[model samples]
Target: MLHPEDVPTLREREHGRNLEGCCGPHGGTGPNLACPCGSLVATLLADCLGPWEVRLHPLRTWAHDPTGA
Candidate 1:
């Protein structure tokens, strides 16, 4: 699980993707985060009853260093 602050490009998904919890989002249904280009990328679990974190989809993400370091 990744911190929401670690992924600044992801935004809350619309159309009920964040409607699985009472206080916040449970993130058990499916991807609830999208990229700047509007592509589903990860699931955000921030419900008041569970651990809060962002789970990224393995097939939808990768690591890179613009500095080539």
Candidate 2:
């Protein structure tokens, strides 16, 4: 799990693969041991991290997205 501060609370879709920071034992601050976004984590945690957050499909939603993505 990521330390509350470093977590973006949401992720954007990268089509097939979206590897952001690492959600490994050391978290995003350490070496990236695994991909932290998409179906991988969703299968493990039962919730797709990408779709759970604000989606970039809408331009009006950008400001509320907080990701600046």
Candidate 3:
């Protein structure tokens, strides 16, 4: 469990990453540009908590089953 103080709130500005490219890839304002430090922090958190798994929501299917008719 993360400590209350250690866990950053969305309202906090200090927890956000810098757009200046500190820890992220060089040039063209990479992936971290939008959130900056948040990416690194999130990576660390994911590592500590074990590998993260993401499930994509199903997309709409336009084709209907003709065999049923």
Candidate topping TM-score: 1
Locate the minimum summed-lDDT window of 10 residues in model 3: 52-61
Say which prediction, candidate 2 or candidate 3, comes out ahead on lDDT: 2
Point out the worst 10-residue segment of candidate 2 by lDDT: 24-33
lDDT string, candidate 3, 24-64, tens digits: 22222222211233322221112232332211112311335
Model 1, residue 3: what's the lDDT?
88
Candidate 2: segments with Cα more than 4 A from true spot: 1-16, 24-52, 59-69
Flag regions of model 1 displaced more than 4 Å: none
What tens-digit string does per-residue lDDT give for candidate 2 at 41-61?
Answer: 211121333222222223222
Q: How many backbone clashes does candidate 2 have?
A: 0
Candidate 2 pairs with clashing backbones: none
Superposition TM-score, candidate 2 onto the true structure: 0.16
Order the candidate numbers by TM-score, best to worst: 1, 2, 3
Cα distance off (Å), candidate 2, residue 56: 3.6
lDDT per residue for candidate 1 within 2-34, as digits (tens), equals: 988998988998776565798889887888899
